[model samples]
Target: MTTAPTRFAPSGPLTGTVSVPGDKSISHRSLMLSALAVGESRITGLLEGEDVLATAAAMRAMGADILRGDDGVWTVHGVGVGGLMQPGQALDMGNSGTSTRLLMGLVASHAITCTFTGDASLSHRPMGRVIEPLSAMGADVSASPGGRLPLMVRGLAPAVPLEYRLPVASAQVKSAVLLAGLNIPGVTRVIEPVATRDHSERMLKGFGADISVETDADGARIISITGEAELKPQTIAVPGDPSSAAFPIVAALIVPGSDVTLTGIGMNPTRAGLIGVLRDMGGDIETLDEREVGGEPVADLRVRHSALSGIDVPPDIAPSMIDEFPVLFVAAAFAKGTTRTSGLDELRVKESDRIAVMAAGLAEIGAQVEEAEDGLTIIGTSGDMLPGSAHPIASSLDHRIAMSFAVAGLHCRDGASVDDMHPVQTSFPTFEPMLRGLAEA
Candidate 1:
């Protein structure tokens, strides 16, 4: 679906308690793991966004009986390990790269041949990162010329146990290999040179997998999973998505006198780098009622408007907040000094080239931004209202880019807008409404 250009102006003091959607990473894992277990698994707070729903649809097509009730709970009856039936047709993954890669792993050792397809955005993302690992486990694979989507995989029932080392720091690649290990006969090991998000490892343990993780002498992680195992079903309560919460949190920080409370956000250390970076910028963010939910850290964030100053973002923290850099760039544009970030080679491969997209958009809107091959260096406006763009910014079908620009609009003197708002539906379906609610309040 397409949307017309919508402009946003400075709305003073956005005050209210806001609850964002369920965590996308956790939500996708819950559904996939639930669909691989015996009996029924119930999940509350599943993200109903287009990307996550695409994963749900793919699971249902593979013989998992998935149902969502009027009470907002999702129930799934799995086909168990090595029990997935051949799908009747191609699996359409929509705009979710996570679904395509991870599902490829599940189908790698299932004795079934499946074809995966996706929208323009998802189809363009490289699938070779996942295909390489799964193929090492004996899956026959073929993809488009550039190893992009429109891919086919023929699983081998008795796949080989692999000891693959990650070439890049990717949670998706790490998770894909571990998932392919589920139906293999022996132990499958993955050597991670750099630490990434551990949602898969955590949720696998929660669902009764024989998974072990150890840190080596060199700080690399060695993760091993025993195959031919049975999975136990359990009730899962998803935490609020910190990635989605970033928009409003930064919104509250940049707009003077704005005070916003975001409740139930996931504070998983692997995904909390943005919070730490923002705090280091002198942002007024308070953690309230810290607790645990679904084996992950959870908290309510009380954010008030503050004077923010930019610093050199540590490159090591990039993996934790990979999905959040676009908004971080937005936050950087309003800071008091120069904000420089590097070691983000992965940004070039997202749904859109985030570094290029944000740099161009920010520059057009009167911010001094320098684009690099992997990252961007921005000279902030020093809390000054920017002379907003003459025309709408191009979002390039990226949800994060779309939302980041929307947040930038709140402080624009002439207001700001994007060519399309439809991309936000993939991760934050209520983003527009939520912003409207805050404005009206």
Candidate 2:
């Protein structure tokens, strides 16, 4: 596959209503959980992107029969609980840390020996966070140096389930431990000091897994899932990805006289903090037709251009919207005053070093931004556009950074470009096209 450079220039006000792709996180869990259930599971609005495709392929390698209909519906026949066979080849997870970590958990207690591999980016991510707890549960896992990928696992069915306290705030790590416990005969518990997305737990329960959550002192969440549990096949209607909808939402906020309506955006409280943060910054965002879908909150957002002002972001909200920071930084650029964010140590370890990349790119665009070890301090432009420099930002093959600056360029005077837009296929394949369509106001 050839890597391509892409650029975006100043555009007209965005005025339209559009639906984004399916939630990548939910889509991954849908496929995984659906593949774990007996009988047939039907899923609509599944994200047809590279990363989720990797998850689909990995499940297929494990003997789940997954097929797509002419109308884009997915029908999957799961191998059922504890029925996974040892794959003949290594599972290749292409540039998806979510797939790699979560599936590692699924494979942990299956009595199957599986080799897990990935592309260059996913290969570099540390698997130790998952390995530590899964190892404690008696799954035999071995990784490359520094506990990275190209790893292998020999699972022990009926693996021991243990109580885990998260040392960090990662939904992926939390979900991994829970997914691994699905085959164990007892309670599998994860105590999170910082709450992350609860998609896995929510979806697991929807599939008929016995799971419950309780809040402890200090507001930590204790999620317990009972395993040796059967997950009934479900017909899931996946909502639009809030993360994918974020680009257009922010674009509408920063672009002058713009009003864009995004429908079917997931509003799960744990994952919808970005809306609250942006609202606090004086963004003219409205939520209408709020309702429930597939056990998660869903809503339509009508975002109109407003005069944004920067403020201190609550550190506790970091886990809720970790993936939205790159675009949030772009919004910070177009706001007034300084936007200060902390408690983002995890940003350093995402698909790219988001902190360093965002700070550097903002500086390149003539935005006054300061980078810290864990966070950033961005002095906003007070409604003025950044000086888009001649050089293109090096996207580092991360999809969010590439798409974020593309949104920033919509408001910048000189426009901006990215080193590689190909990575956008990982999460939001329709990003460039959707953005272009939105420009037709």
Candidate 3:
């Protein structure tokens, strides 16, 4: 539901310690793989945002017994491998592309047919990437024109194992194929030319799936998973999402005199690309107490306001921090010199055309930006305040875009207003409250 425009104004130094929501990607997979295991599995630190909740709902619809307790612990009773029942109605994915694509993979190898639908924003995004590989495994697909959402998939029991190569560096598409492999008769293999997040791979091993990853001679990842495997239930502790932490970390950097400590942020190598980029640009972000949590590396980040300089962002790291480009663009706006970013065509296909939306929104607030087909060239204000947008910035129903601009407003001379803050609930529901707490600190 749309709400009144939210105004974010310049405030005093933001100083405090806080923890963001759980890892959305891991939360989704935890519920999913847990539902496919033999016994009950418990999960703590799961993200309760709308997107991850949508995954929980979909899993429940497929015959998994899922419940949350008063203590914030979630328990899932499994239906076991190849044990999903046909949903009585269409699976509503809300605004989550991850749930839509990954769940489609689960439905693709079972003896059931399900229709996937979503909100207007998600309906516009393409589903063809996952469809291509799932179809090869003998799943019959009937999709809307242009392979968009409101699509149906008829699973083929005893589905053929497939050897597929990723056309794009997308974890969702790769996971879709791998998930479908779980119920097939033999091994299903995916060759990833450019590696994305490895949450699926790690979780599959933890769940007792016969999955292995090998780096071929040409440096492509060969991921193979055997079918007809029994999954073992295990307790999971999800870590704080790095993506959600991006906004506060950047706010601390760009807002003068701000110092903030973010606790227990996931430091997955595949997802921590933003930290490296920011450090290279001279942001004073310190990592403290590096440790392992739930099989993933994590740390506390102490971010202090510092003079920032711009540098060219390497394109190869795009897969690792793709979700962070919006806030990174905002960070670049306040830096000194020019920051050039390319090879981010994935941003064009996100919830909004992030490249276009960010470029337009940043320009409206008086930042010097050049938009390109694949990336942006942002000329920073050299740590000067921007003249905030005279009108509400159109958020285009994107959570990341909305939060990124809200951070941008912290250093704006006139403050910033977003046309809709409703979208933030999809990922970081506590974002506004957290920002409020930090400003009050």
Candidate 4:
């Protein structure tokens, strides 16, 4: 067990031009899809964090020839569709749900069985969502009680296609089903009630998959993909993660007289809802040099400290910014009035119960917060000092929760501290240094 911990203390404002790491979701997909493509695929700006690296290693173990060039490029030689070999050892996914769930999809369509495990935190996360859909497609999955991890998946060759309607808005679940569809015989379809991040769809299409998306009358999306299409090698460039950019952005917003520009951020409409909420609260934000990078939108974000007012965030927008709710709560704490976020039942199933965790932490820091069944409402102190007489927050080994409250500490009267930061390495190993550099600048 890792025991070291770090605390973030920001005394003054933050200012600088900084670029965060590659998009985690895209990075994972890039490696996995590239490993299934024929011939050599090159990837630049891929996230080298632990989670993505774990996926890269898993692909290598499954017979893909993956290498990192001196120029920081990743090259993968795939085994083609229905060609993945059984891994000799158990695949340890660490703390990445994206890796674990998506990999299950890939394994489910092959004629092999694999055992998967993870860290303590990841082992407790729910896998039933992905397992249920894959099971419907003829794969056999067995897990611990309550659908927890440390599970085994027996793949089915020429698996049956499935038309699944998602009960929850989760990119991981959607991506898992799509991955399984790759080796199935016919079209695999998924209907999503509200749009989640479409990185999987976008990346799958980029790899030459026969995929199409159409909107239904009720605003749901019908995504269909023809199974067993040959994926050709393609060059990929991953963009900076907006979720990681949220910490510094929020820190810049609440700190007095702060101005910072984040360059080359992925501006996918589905994942840019944090910017929307910030703008709705009257934040001083600007998008400069908007352009497309690797089939996704990219931009330089200029953020300056401004007085913010709270507003009701509609539940419909939850799918667009699901991973960012923790930091959004921090921004709400410094805004005037109450910021209520609903339709966030998804937060309960993440690495941690984010709604409960954030509500507890915020209340400990002297903010007025109320927890709901699906979401939470936070009443901003409007720059009022958060009294930190309470104990430091335990991150529960969740990377986003650890980083979110660390940013919140900057604007709090007593500056918050978190118990475990090891999980941050799973997504953003550079988070501490990047945040510290911004503080010094």
lDDT of 4 by residue, 1-441 (tens): 666555565578899999999999999999999999999999999999999998998998899999999999999999998999999999999988899999999999999899999998899899999999999999999998888889999999989999999998888899999999999989999999889999999989999999999999999999999999899999999999999998888889988889999999999999999999899998989999999987999999999998889899999998888999999998898898999989898898889999999998888778899999999899997866576533668888899999988888887777788888888998888998888888888
lDDT of each: 0.93, 0.92, 0.96, 0.91
**How many Å off is the CA of 404 in candidate 4?**
1.0
- lDDT string for model 3 (1-441, tens) is 548898899988999999999999999999999999989999999999999999999999999999999999999999999999999999999999999999999999999999999999999999999999999999999999999989999999999999999989999999999999999999999999999999999999999999999999999999999999899998999999999999999999999999999999999999999999999999999999999987889999999998999999999999999999999999999999999999999999999999999999999999999999999999999999999975999999999999999999999999999999998989898999999999998
The per-residue C-alpha lDDT of model 2 at residue 127 equals: 90
lDDT of 2 by residue, 1-441 (tens): 766667788888999999999999999999999999999999999999999999999999999999999999999999888988889899999999999999999999999999998888778788999999999999999899999989999899889998999999889999999999999989999999888999998999999999999999889899999999898999999999999988999999998989999999899998898999999999999999999989989999999999999999999899889999999999999999999999899888889899999999999888999999989999999988887865889888899999999998888888998888988999899998888888885
Evaluate model 3: give its lDDT.
0.96
Q: lDDT: which candidate is best?
A: 3
lDDT of 4: 0.91
In Å, residue 388's CA in model 4 sits off its true spot by: 3.2
Write down the RMSD of all candidates, one decimal each.
0.8, 0.9, 0.7, 1.2
Residue 60 C-alpha lDDT in model 2: 94
Candidate 1: regions farther than 4 A off: none
TM-score of 2: 0.99
How far residue 122's Cα lies from its native spot in candidate 4, in Å, is 0.9
Q: Give the CA lDDT, 0 to 100, for residue 120 in model 3.
A: 94
